[model samples]
Target chain A: MSSTAGSTLTHQETDLHLQGVINRPYQVVVWNDPVNLMSYVAWVFRSYFGHSKEKARELMLQVHHRGKAVVSSGAREKMERHVTAMHNYGLQATLEEAE
Target chain B: MARAFRATTRGYKADLESHERRLLSQLCADVITMLETRGKQLTGDDAPAGTDAEDDYAHFRRELAGLGDQIDGSDAAGGLAPPDDAALARLLPDASSDPQEAAQFRRLSESSLRESKLADLRAARMALEGEPVSLTEEQAPVFGRALNDVRLTLASRLGVEDEADAEQIHQMAKAGSAATTEALMAELYAFSTWLQETLFSAMLDVMPEDD
Candidate 1:
């Protein structure tokens, strides 16, 4: 599904094709929880995932507004690890196969 | 008691009175016990033993099936398993959307997670009991984690959903019309949140700046 005007393959199109060929990634989704503070969630994102402060806040806001947000996507093992870590930190998180 | 935590040469320090130390230790101990109990339940360690051969065989078959499902990552025909209590639910969230996958993940990781939580609580309790209460840089994170857990438990009990709820609790407590349990829990929740925030800031102060 190329949206670009150019007939030649675009970088975005190529990346999508590569992702289709490779093993499908699994995503770790963090859900909004009443007990966890927004600032704390942002801090966890920054500290655990090495995300920058701005990016962490952006993800945290998405979780707040959207009920949940995909915080990380990768191999099944890594996603499982990330979900466990989130649970340890007392955040509501779940893993799902990425579409 | 007064806010006791502060930055220190070693890492972080808190000078709590004997009673305060006892209270903190007791809270941590309670958390440890609850987590251990829940862990046992999750792993089916608390399953009742069967006296008859047929019953024993059935139990064995059930355990074998569970192990097989965990290995294959099959979805158990159900929604998420409900938490034993609100506090436990807050402490341990589901790790996967699929019911079976979540059960498998819980079986694999719940023990280690419980152990780490227990270790953190015990570390905090030990520091509270030690002469000249202090936590080294390494130990401070453990204490922080324990504090976070306590706050989560208290907040869950208090039904603290957002800032507005917290503010209302404080106002009700101040008005002297609130129930004793609600007032006391709200106070504890606020205190724990303050302590956690202070300790976290102290820990951050000691960290080396990025190049």
Candidate 2:
């Protein structure tokens, strides 16, 4: 229950909301691979995710050095489609629950 | 589209040759190092980070994708370097669709055509050994086409069409011109590396969450 001092969430309402509400976030995770080039990875992010070249490259670098990066968070189905498309394009990619 | 034959030919064998493969792998390692360095540059620079490296990487990927698209387009256009459809037919397990069948036919035709080139090489070797064998008129064309195919395949893959240029580069490299070949090899290696990275990044952006 996200109730605070200034917020008027009545006790009855808070109890009712707490009964059964779960927020499940899906995360798009890119994995490091030996085959792909870093620049190419960045380009892909730009093209597919509509990320600006700079943002895409930054994400690519993070994935390159860090070995992985969560590029997006949203619905599970959307993430699945994205993963499949990446695989089709010859990239090693996957999805996971957002931490 | 109707199938048309060009005076040109190409093969994947050369593209995936042992030496080429080895060179490509080495190039990939170098690219990784470059990526790491670029990343460091981004992190170390306090001034508007992220843009420079990212832009460069995107351009690199676009170059690779452009190369791929060029080759595929050539195949469609039935240019002089149209792939050997006949060889593909022989290799394909099944040709379910018309397009698939067409590709196979092109591959097979090229292979059958290249057999004569192999024979010519053998003949040349025999001549060097002081053994002579006469060839029929038909046999002569086979050798010519086979060699032509090899040349075109290399040309198209490299996004070039000038046979003269290809031969010149080939000769220079064979003659131990290290600097020139090194530069060319570096480029090809970068291309392959970029291709791999582009696919990886694209997949990461689009893949769904696991259960």
Give candidate 2's error at residue A87 in angstroms. 1.2
Query: What is the TM-score of each predicted model, taking all chains together?
Result: 0.74, 0.31
In model 1, what are the clashing residue pairs, if there are any?
A: none
> How displaced is residue A62 in candidate 2, in Å?
0.3
* lDDT (10s digit) by residue, model 2, range B1-211: 1111122122111123344444433433332333333333323433255565854564455345442213222233342122222221121112112343333333333333233334443442332222122223333223222222222223344433333554454554455535665546434534333333332333444434322
lDDT for residue B180 in candidate 1, whole number 0-100: 85
Q: Residue A95 of model 1: what lDDT? A: 89
Tell me how each candidate scores on DockQ against the true complex.
0.37, 0.03
- Candidate 2 colliding pairs, count: 33
Mark the 10 consecutive residues where model 1 chain B has the least summed lDDT.
B67-76
On DockQ, the leading prediction is 1
Interface RMSD of each: 2.4, 15.5
